[model samples]
Target: MMRRIGLLIFLGLLATLLIFPAVRAEEKKTDGQMPSLTGNIEGGFRLVDVDGSRNKFREHYNLDTGPRLLNLSLNGNYRSSRILDDFRLQANGVGGDPYQNYSLLVNKDRLYTFEASFKKSDYFYNTITYPVSRPDGNQTSFEEAHAFGTSRENTDFKLTIKPENLFKLTLGYSRMEKEGTTFLTALTTAVPPDVTLITTPVDEIDDFYFASAEFSLSIFDFYFEQDYRKSDNKLNFLSDPTANAAVELHESQTVKESLQTLRQPISRAKVHTLLFDKLDLSTNLVYSNSDFDVDINRPKDQFQAVRPPTTGEGSLNKKIWIWDMEASYSLLNSLTVHGIGQISELKQNGNITFTGSSRDTTEDGTVINKIFSHTVGAELEYVPLKDLSLNGGIKRQFRKLDFTRISQFNPPPPIENPVILQSGDTIYTLGFFWKPLTSLDFMGRVLIGEFNNPYTNISSTDTENIKFRVRYRPLRTLAFSATHAERNTENTTTFFKSNFKSDGISIGYQPVAKLDLNVGYTLQEGKSFSFFSSADAACFAFNPDAVNLCGGVNGAFVAEYQARSNILSADALYAITKKIKVGLDVRNIESSGTISFHFSDLGVFLGYLWPYNLETKLKYQWITYDEVVLNANDYVASVVTLSLGLNF
Candidate 1:
């Protein structure tokens, strides 16, 4: 509550300064002529995959796009009747994207104001990894990478107007698209590894719209904005994973397919106002919706028999909605308070059209799901002395979820076939913040929750956090600081679970405007083998059996990661020109436990800061994983990225 009130006063004073015409705009005339326009462009790439013999970076959720890009502006005049007008172009125009740009901003001023921009990034080359075992019945030894390529394009435009400077309105639109493909043969499962898994191709796209209003005057000021966005992602999930659909291999095998669709929609709005000298208030609202669609064609008792297949198509669709609202009020002179609250609803309403060759398998798949939640909180801030202040807050959070599954295949075939699952939990929290010295900062928050009903462990855990940092400059060209942060999550999936924790500190120094250097270390701790999956645990229920995998010193899958780790990295930037700059960044990660993994990243890029200016950039990224093991599967690759943009 206090935080909101404080910020309210801050905005009140800011609006007073703006509408009073007392503030000076930063503009300078150059030799009585228009200023010349200038800017640059950059792009780069990188590949990350599991470390091993078959090291390709291909898998679900492609991230291997070698090239990333940026679009922007520098030295822009927000109040010009005649805005920027410019041109420049570059590259082979690969993927229909020129490393540079060509543009013209002209026309007259009107009640309606408009702005537009475009961005395109060069190709992406990457891969991901999965575990593998040799025919020799060996437990470990092979690794592979799935090579993928990428392409992307985006654009946006907006228009606004104020017939009266005291009342303004605006509207805008945007679009984005991305696509990628694999570069290998379909030997996806060949021993010694076949390249077949790389045969799938996928692409995604999105469109958006926005509208808002803002007004200002000497005695009063008001602000408001509303936006609605919708996006749909598509993919052809595998209907079957078996090598031969006509022949069954395992008696009780798990069916694998990627038949799912995700759709998202979001609407948001905000309103704020300032009065006389001491009062201010604001209210904000947001609504979000997610639509889920799943389709699966399978033979009943899909795992049991090769003959007499119970095959058909089934789908489950779900929708979720969320609402959030926040408001605050403040008195300008001294004391202040604020509060915020939110509620969420996940409701599913859909149908599953079913099709099959036989009547026994012909059934419409329909189901419903719902989740409800609420969160409320408030805070207070008091200044006891000119340079001293105190802050505190209390919050309550609650969540409830219910899932009901209805089907005609129930063995008993009852009158009303429905499966219901109910879950919920409540939490209490406390927080504090103190800044006793100009160079010192402190903050802390603690939360505890009890659950009679909970859907996931992450949703009902008790947590704690504490952090501190200090910055001091002993000389004009030299400065340094240290910081430590840690977090703990309890009441995990089970009582056997141990909290996760990490602590770290670092020192940094900068001797010039173009150079920066810093180094730091962190230690991480986690739970052990008892945290393994129930099925994997049952494998070691016996002492001798357990020793083979979890043994006395180390357990199994749950204990595979190290408990303590350290990281060392340094980032730096150098200005090539007032409008252009270059950067270099590197990091090294090391672990203390036997299962710990070590890795590193090296990045280099150039940045351009010209407004509505086409900028092109090149980037190179390299990564090395599991540095401790002398395993040949340990591999490296080079990625190159090219990008073009205008105020992106």
Candidate 2:
């Protein structure tokens, strides 16, 4: 509530300032030219219609293009040297399944500025029909119920002050509200049949406050910032039709309610400076704290005593602190060196209670997760000729995690035990740019990285990446470009390795002054091998009777797959007349793998401009999707849109 009042007051001040005229319309300009507002206001209305399967179309595409609606679009700008230096506002919205946005900005000289904006969106969750098989090798189709939908709104306001050359300040605030219906699953397997399937209605709100200031002088600059946020959520669970029969068995208490809240605060300080014109340094420190609380209410009549809500009435508190310093030095005319050191510490403590029929029990504990890291690197550049340059760099990073977990659930073992985890990586990179001819250019780079983790002895990885690009413009109206990239990761943990490679090319041609054409194609392929770990809990459940099948420390190779994909896209636009233009875009994507699928879409539009600043546009698009293994989910959609606009 306070945030809303603050925002309102801020806007009120801007409104008051806007009431005064910047200057008289008849006033003469100092430069011997009349001063007037130079901006265009455009108003438009759009008509959209959807065809084909609603379920498939609605899910695959945004609702604005899938439904019938009358939309509005407005944009304008104003500037003056008197009361306000610059001002702008924009608003647009769709009527049906409306998504709306509004924003305004005003600036006076270079000292003060104000901004406000709001946005909202509506979403839908449609039901689906699929085949449901029975244990007796029988299959039947079932249509799921239509669940509830969701809506969200957000608002933001900001004020800036730059009164002097040495210091500047900015203050901003934002709020968000979300309300929707969501599916809820039972927490325990012991719930009654009717309570297994439920729906949760949700209403949540979040607020944020931010403030930052910066001061600079000569070669030194400093910044200080703070941020605070709060959130509250209320949720209620109710039995759905699937659980209707079970609801009758327990009629007294059929609803559960939960309330949750979170509060967080963060602060940061940073400083940067250059010394002797040869070395540049910067440092930053940050601290953040968060508090979370949740309360649940369950009817005693509906739920049994054994599952008494797991009632937790306590709050959790967590804190994090981070500090980092970075430095760069110009070692020579063609070389520079850079290094950074950073550390982060995190701590969390919480206590929770479980309500039982006899009494309530409480468990409390704390955890510390700390990380220290360092990085150093150097870069070199050599230009022997005007058209050729070579660049190379190498960086090494080391990190250590001193983590301690001593909670009620994970008590420390006896006999003085300690554990620490450490990991780091080294990276090397080299690249070059060469222009052999006036119309030809080439660029390429290579990167290699070696990494180790706490489990490095058992599992580690090395990665290599290479990319090259070339462009040629032999003609004034034509250009061609091509690129190739490859990456591979080799893991020693369990004979796991993966590789990806891609090649693409594009051509742009301007046959005439009013026409342009562009086409591009890409091909990608990937291969990987993965071993299934028997230690996974799911393995035990899958083969309980035959433990030897997949229940050992050294799991067997369970999966190996290769994936390949191709993408082709083209666009062409032409100006038939001074007031008319037409354009077409086409895209096709195909994939082959264990999970193979294909998608393609084509769109065309025609635009016309009439006298008196009037304009009209007509667009049509078609999209299709196909699945080799699951054809039931494939569908096609055709859309048409028409819009009219007027500019003043």
Candidate 3:
């Protein structure tokens, strides 16, 4: 019924447009007049090969063989416009372990304008492998072992309407889906009895609706917007996985089955204004109230003849709420600042349910859990010199987390968990743009991690980031540019968490405007922000002897860290004739040793007006791991992907 209602509303809007009087031609000033009807569509295809093999800290450092996968993709976009009229449509479809983006867009204008579209994106895992050795001497097997390929999906819809003057309204809907979370697993013994390692999968759904309206007032840039949004969610159970379950592979594992569903609502209002032509300021106030339940399942069982007698039952529902507000200001020719504050509350009022031969029982527990967060930041980029510029900013945040829970059994649990976090951050930047002859500029972000967060265990990390760049335009078509960067992350978790003190340098060259090349290399050793205690040890090792050695490796898995790695990417395009063209693209990475990932893509084009386009990509790679998983090289795997696309 809801779907039908949505369709009906969409149809009704379309009908209203048809019944309205014809839209007269728009009369806008222009240096010259030309018949509209102008647009171009470009479509291309890609193929990728991925190794699904589980990667080990050893292989990550040694460069071993792992899993191999194949993927294909096609994308395109087009737009047309006249004196005062325009329209656009764009779409792209793809499948791969990498995050995929696909969207559709349409724009039109009568007296004003209206636009609507839908987009979906998916982020997949990095790789996977198998036949890894357990911390124990025996080998372990994961019929479907995946180092990374869990996925996060984002689906959203939007609508925009502008009626010449007076007001504009926008309504949108978005859903965030997180599925199949990964966990490092390991076993203690070769023979499995009692229970095999099982780390539950984590999944969740967040559905929301947003609507906002803006009214134009006064000659100055003045506007106001009111927003309303609500969220509803559903949660389910994921498979129990094992391997790094006991190690420091991750910060903290989810206590629940790793999946959840919730329903939340939000509403907000903000007014923005510009006093002068060069200065702008805006303040926004937003409040969100959500009512939802978070539940964890407890399995019923009989432990060693002590039949706990607990069967077929679960706990009551728990809830959480969040509220936040933000504001910002920008000077067209000078500086900018932004700030926000938020509060969150969680209720623990839940009743437990139990079953018996003669009666069913319900129990209640203590309600608990609350958190508050605040942040403010600003940046000033001033061009005081004709060829030099300065940029800097400061940010601060404070957080407090409290939790509470009660049990009918003996010792009472804390009413709430206690955690406090705060930080004071700052950044400084410098740049130079000089027309030394014709075409040359230098830019850099030689910044630092000035945030000092004392509540928890943290370090004052430093940065040695520097970039040298230059652009030359000897002639219009004969343009070229080059750049190089030397960067360092000292015990920092800024651009990426788990990044250790490392140095990386990258160089890129571009010629003929259509061709580009880049290469980068990095080396590092870092600690994970999670389970890694000040003391280095495998937090999971059952014995004091192996704990430090085994659990410590998990901290080495950095979603953003490619240690001892090298990367190369390049793209080139050439017009063989007026109707035919060719292009080439390549991407390669060497995490360690000779074991690496590489992709070579080729493309061809022919025809005009209603043109024809086609492209193909070939990829290859082998991976390996170390003490963390398989015995250095206990596992191996590979695959290849091919794709095709067309444009009109």
Candidate 4:
């Protein structure tokens, strides 16, 4: 109702500016200081316990059981005030939280400044099951009856005028909302086409308006901005022909869909300069235009056995352009030079119309799309000594695409070509940094790329990337670090290949005088190779005849995938006196080859300082998930939190 009365009058004007600076803390004194209030206010209570799949514990920690405002802050400052000078208010996870946030800021110094923010989030998903091989060679297991959940909200407001330098102005507004439930799939004219799952309801909304301007003299600095956006989407589908009764006989439907979108006046410009005193420059521009509309309704459908009702309509137009430029030079006193450029363009047009009740399901369609892109780069840097540094760079990129499709269905349609694509890439880079001693340090980077698409065969003609880092400190509390990364890609006309690798190590320690420590480890690997089709490898061998396994060159083959991950982390802190403190955190993860998993996390915390500026905290957490090949999507969770605070 009126958005909960405008969110309770914006939380009662932020609780009257957070209690009017603590009730005028001893009044009197405007320019002689007296308006100062620091921040802190916290409250919390949370407990959660789950032992196995509450849909994988809400897909991993969507905590519940709570009374919380876990954190809040208020800050104020009024020195020589006519109205206000500084203010801030903050909040987090209010109550009954799946996620929540609130923020406010006000300032009146060089005229005005104001800001507001709000956020909320929640989402969940579940649906997994495998094994299905039948065509008389029986094997059964299924559960792809989809599931999705959602809740999203965001709001923002901003106002700024004259602050931090010559000529400035700003205005803004934003809103977003999403609500949901999902699952949709339909087809049931029987005879090898009986897949039916429908349960969909979703609503979405978005709105935004923005404005900006800034200017500065003496050599240059300028900016401009304007924006507008709107979107609305909805969907509802209801079908339950006895809900997939052992897979078949499903054709009772009711569907409705609508979509609307508009984007206009989205423009931006920017410029920056420093000319002569070692030269530096920047430039940017952006443009946008968009339009969209869609509608679909299927009053009731069961077709052929007569139940008919269908309709559809669609429209779209889009445009986008972007530009960028950058420059830098200091060619001496340790040399430096850099340059960059970018450009982008896109255009699209669309149309679709359908009305069915036979006539072979009336249809009409048209669509066109185009794209262009460009990039250029240059870089050079060298620092003869004094901790050493060297770098080199080169870049070139180009892209072009065109697509078109037109139809008016009749017994003639299989392939009607109108597609074009052009691609190019050339990238080379090298980087380095070294500190030859005094506790050592080193860094490295290398990249190589070359690509040319002769109209794609899954693109990627050659690519490689490598990185390395190292750091060490003998003692003063000991420290060490290491990292390595690699990437590779190749696709000599569909002999596709891919690779990725990573390694990391870290350690930090403070050993005494109040203890502190940290440890880390990470490893990741990935591999891929592709070329399928034997009716997609017989539907990944779940084969229900897979449409009688299509023809061609021994039905094509070669398909491989691999993934690996290992991570371990640890942290600790201790102070136990002068107001006490303690903390610990641990995490572990292991995953191997094509979807295998094990994960664990443990956390502990305790803090106290009660004596006037009161503060207290206690936390505990444990989480685990093991799904070595879907053990019914394993899960285990436990969490507890307690907090209290006051510091002003």
Candidates' lDDT values, in order?
A: 0.48, 0.67, 0.41, 0.74
Task: Compose the digit string of candidate 1's lDDT tens values, residues 233-267.
Answer: 44422223432221111122333333445555555
Per-candidate count of clashing residue pairs (backbone under 3 Å): 56, 0, 50, 0
What lDDT is obtained when candidate 2 is compared to the true structure?
Answer: 0.67
Tell me which of candidates 2 and 3 scores higher on lDDT. Answer: 2
| lDDT tens digits by residue: candidate 2, 543-648 | 3233244434442224466889999999999999999999999999899985577888899989999998777878788888876766655777776777666666
Stretches of candidate 2 above 4 Å error?
1-21, 24-53, 64-80, 91-101, 119-154, 176-204, 233-260, 294-309, 355-391, 394-399, 402-419, 432-440, 445-467, 486-500, 526-563
Candidate 3 residues 97-195, lDDT tens each? 233444333445533343333333333332233453332344335422444323456666777777664566777777666655444333322334222
Candidate 4 achieves a global lDDT of: 0.74
As for lDDT, the candidate ahead, 3 or 4, is 4
Worst 10 residues of 2 by lDDT: 244-253
For model 1, the local distance difference test gives 0.48
Worst-scoring 10-residue span by lDDT in model 1: 243-252
Q: List where candidate 3 sits over 4 angstroms from the true fold.
A: 1-84, 94-104, 110-154, 176-184, 188-204, 218-259, 275-280, 299-367, 372-379, 401-438, 450-562, 593-648
Give a tens-digit lDDT track for model 4, residues 268-340.
9999989888989999999998888878775555424365666788887889999989998998989988999
